[model samples]
Target chain A: MRAAIFRGAFAIQVEQIPDAALLEPTDAVVQITHACICGTDLWPYRGQGPYQPGWQIGHEWMGIVQDIGSEVRTIKRGDRVIASYDFCDGTCEFCLQGLDSACVQGGLWGFGHEGGQAEAIRACFADATLVVVPPEVEGDEALLKAILPLTDVMAAGHHAAVSANVRAGGRVAVIGDGAVGLCATLAARRLGAEQIIVLGHQPQRLALARQFGATDIITSNGDEAVQQALEMTQGGAQAVLECVGAKETIQMAVTLSRPGGTVGFVGAPHGQEVPLGHMFSSNIGLRGGLAPARAYLPELLAEVLAGRLDPSSVLDRTVSLAEVAAGYAAMDQRQAIKVMVRP
Target chain B: MRAAIFRGAFAIQVEQIPDAALLEPTDAVVQITHACICGTDLWPYRGQGPYQPGWQIGHEWMGIVQDIGSEVRTIKRGDRVIASYDFCDGTCEFCLQGLDSACVQGGLWGFGHEGGQAEAIRACFADATLVVVPPEVEGDEALLKAILPLTDVMAAGHHAAVSANVRAGGRVAVIGDGAVGLCATLAARRLGAEQIIVLGHQPQRLALARQFGATDIITSNGDEAVQQALEMTQGGAQAVLECVGAKETIQMAVTLSRPGGTVGFVGAPHGQEVPLGHMFSSNIGLRGGLAPARAYLPELLAEVLAGRLDPSSVLDRTVSLAEVAAGYAAMDQRQAIKVMVRP
Candidate 1:
């Protein structure tokens, strides 16, 4: 099997690797069909995080099960499935509370376990970790790419909106306008927010955000953006989704929210500090983190299958497995919002 | 009339002042029976806040209505009442949302409007601001003093508990051992939290915290306190109430919470910065502010009248209006957790 392996900062290679097999009764081997790049993937790629040479380098995927272990009762070979970026037992106290991302036995794919960037990948806790993709749309190319991002970004965007308690007729502001932020705008729209603002400086990304239902856009001058959002919302946004993992972005999200409003942050913050003083007196709430992707994928998948939502729009470009390295580089250079790779 | 007026930093005097009278159609004149020293009062007394010389100095009180205007429908002359620290119309969008502290036309009694630290007070928006004292409990000294604190501290404590969503049989941690923190412990217990930890170093305050149903105590060392709380709860506390406005206290509260847990911060934050990196990954939420005291007084008054709760236990000493200066000095020096002043 060939896998996209991390060589070092700013480098990746698609090379022959040892084939993965079922290592436990609860495991399943998936032949990767589609995989996509994520903002989080850029962290290690940019030398901001620890990465080992030859490590499997992707976590987003949709695939077909090539083999299933004896104890895997819910899924079998040849079934199309979408797995979350993080694997969980789904029965732990955290999972039961709808915080599967924090599940005690969970393994973060790509980081903690061998990821799904290869031709074939092993998925653990198959019964609890895999979602059987609905069969009615099995051969749809766009839907297949959509599922890959859904395993992480789309679900994360939904989590951000949900955590902020976005409601019908409410004003919502999405900070970042990255893939997740655009998805959040769509999610907020789906949740019935009447007004949506996407704050970003990138022209292409902001244009995509507007297409995704943002009623307004503000370039990354955070202070001015917050002021404009406040004026537009008659005070401040009823809910704010902070999708960027920087201190300024989070602060802007907090300040843009109305008194008693909520700020849901989904970014994997690397070097950010929250201003608690501003939040305390403003009565703003901060909630969100790693998306409970598995918990949300079913509904998001249904929306995608039903054509009520289109997350595939975020897949600005696609490349073959042999060109996976270039895809990563494009994403690293901010030239692409999202890159999909056909395996 | 005689009133305690703030002259400068560390300077307060009980001296002759003009009597208060009805200033609006919705106004009521009350002869204060008991006015208590509050933690917020120390802010101006110590010159830590913006203060003007010879300003009225208190916001917590229970009194007898001496007069009312044509528009005052809720109470008449001779009615005994306990009013919140801030006056609100109770009909604005914020008030309807149960955030009376941010009411559109709200006025703070001590900071901006004429306060209740004197023998007489002119209360605006009387119908929406005052809670009538039950006849049977009007003369009860403990209940009267309790009513004074209810105008601020007790209500603030309840706000903390409510914002944090403290549940029955859940573990709760309270940061700060001020009157509000002690009241927060009591509020958590009332809301059915089975285990309560109060973080503080003062013996007298900690003893009062215990009396208010704190099951454990963590002295000022926040990091050790978080670890101890996590160990006690088998993970992390389900809810944390931050009653001190310091940055470290806010950080500790955020750290002590479990994933998906909330921290209710009622403290008027002086200067605090939140660590967004940890907050984003942990999924901890923060909610609260200057408590909407006007929203909770009715229920709080009912509880006090029924002998189900007592807030006066926080009062460590009492002084005459003439000796209020000493009371402030005592609280500032940690000689007393709280003090009550009789006019």
Candidate 2:
């Protein structure tokens, strides 16, 4: 099997690797049909996060089940399914509370298990880890490409909206114009936020944001952007989505929220100190952490099948499995928002 | 008039001072019938928070409105009322969203205005700052003292429950065994939390917590308390109320919560760094800052009048205004949960 590997910092390659097989009765093997490179992958790609040579490198995926262990009850062979980047049993206390990301028995893919950016991969807890691709989206290549982002990106955006309690007729400010940020704008719109403001300095990203449903865009960075957001919303937005988990972005998110509004941050935290005094004295509420993307996949998938969502726009570039290394380079260079991988 | 002054660290005095008088048309002078020393007041008492010599200290109050400026509308002279520690313009965007503590026109007391532990207090935005004491409890001294904590402690507990979204049938862990923690146990009961766990050390405070509706008590401290709470809940609590602002308390609050659970912290943040990585990976939602007691005043006032609540039990010691300094000492030494002063 051909698999994408993280060779080292700024180094990636496609190589012949051992084929994936069932290690547990609950496991199922899938032939990767589509996969996507996420912004988070860049952390290790740039050596900001720890990585070992030859680490399997992608998590977002959709594929056809090639085989299933005898114990797998829900998923069967030959069925198409969208994979959850984080594996969960769906019945643990955390998953029962809709927090699938923190599943006690399941962990992130590409860490211990083989990554999705490969010819085939073993999915642990297959009965709970895989959701069948809606029949409406079957055989639709464009839909398949679009729905692939749901495994992480779109579901994350939807999580941001839900976490912030974004209500109809309410205003929200989405910080960071990455794929997650753009998806947040769309998700806020889908959740009925009347005024969606996307804050970022990148013109191209901001433009794509507008197309996704942002009612306004602010092309400024830091404090100035927060001030503009506050002014635009007449004080501050009811919900501020901090999609970039940096110290500055977190602070800006707090500033962009109204006194009683909520700042729901979905980005991976960078150990930023949330301004305790600011959040407390202002009576502002801060929520959201890692999104339970698996919890949101079904709903986001329905939206995609119904044509209310088409997030494939975030897939600005595509590459064959052998060319995934180049795909990573394009994303790192800001030449593309996200890159789709065909296996 | 006599007013309590924060002379220096561990020093408080009730000294003869000029009488409080209306400075604005929206101001009203209240003859304080009751006031209490709060846990947060200890911050400066311990020389932790910023303070000034002879700064007017107290912030909780309930009294008869002796005078009202011409523009005061909702409240009038001779009405018995409960004063919010924080003054606010009811019409401001923040106050409109029930965040009166962050009123655009108001900050906290003791900055420029007279503190509540005085014979008289000039309350700005009288109509918005005071809630009329129901006629039925106008002459009830015990009831008034019981309601005094509502201005800060009890209201804060309620804020924790609401902020953490403690729903009916949910289990909650209230960290801290202070007046606020006891009130939080009471609040979780009021909000319909089924199993209320109180984490603290003092047997007296824990006993009071049970009286206030705590179903379980863990006297152990630190990581042990969290593990015990986790065991009692069979996993982790749905809501965690952090009433102690210490760094370690915040960490415990997160540890006590289940994934997707919320930790509502109402303590004056000692600027403790929230463990973003722990909170993020656990999918734990953190919310709560300052409590807008004024927002919860009306409902709580009704509860008090209806005899559904009697928090005066937290007022373990009583002292005349002349001995107010001793009242501060009692709380500072942990000899009393809270001390009430009659001026």
Score chain A of each prediction against the true chain A by TM-score and list the results.
Answer: 0.97, 0.97
Error of 2 at A231 (Å): 3.3
The models' CA-based lDDT, in order, is 0.86, 0.86
lDDT of 1 by residue, A1-343 (tens): 9988888888878889889899999999999988887878887888877777768889898789999999999998989999988899988988898788888999788874787777989998999999999776677787776667789989989999999999999999999888999999999999999999888889998888888999999884867777888888899998999898777788788888888899998977655466666676667888888888988988898888888888888999998889988988899888899998888
Query: What TM-score does model 1 achieve against the real structure?
Result: 0.97
**How far out, in Å, is residue A335 in model 2?**
2.4
Query: In model 2, what are the clashing residue pairs, if there are any?
Result: A280-B289
Show where candidate 2 strays beyond 4 Å.
A21-25, A48-50, A69-76, B8-11, B46-50, B53-55
| Candidate 1 B-chain TM-score | 0.97
Determine the TM-score of chain B of model 2.
Answer: 0.97
Q: Against the true structure, whose TM-score is highest? A: 1
- Interface RMSD per candidate (angstroms): 2.0, 1.6
Report how far off residue A100 is in candidate 2 (Å): 1.4
Return the clash pairs for model 1, or none: A274-B274, A274-B276
lDDT measured at residue B171 in model 2 versus the true structure, 0 to 100: 93
Residue A21 in model 1: shift from native, Å? 0.7
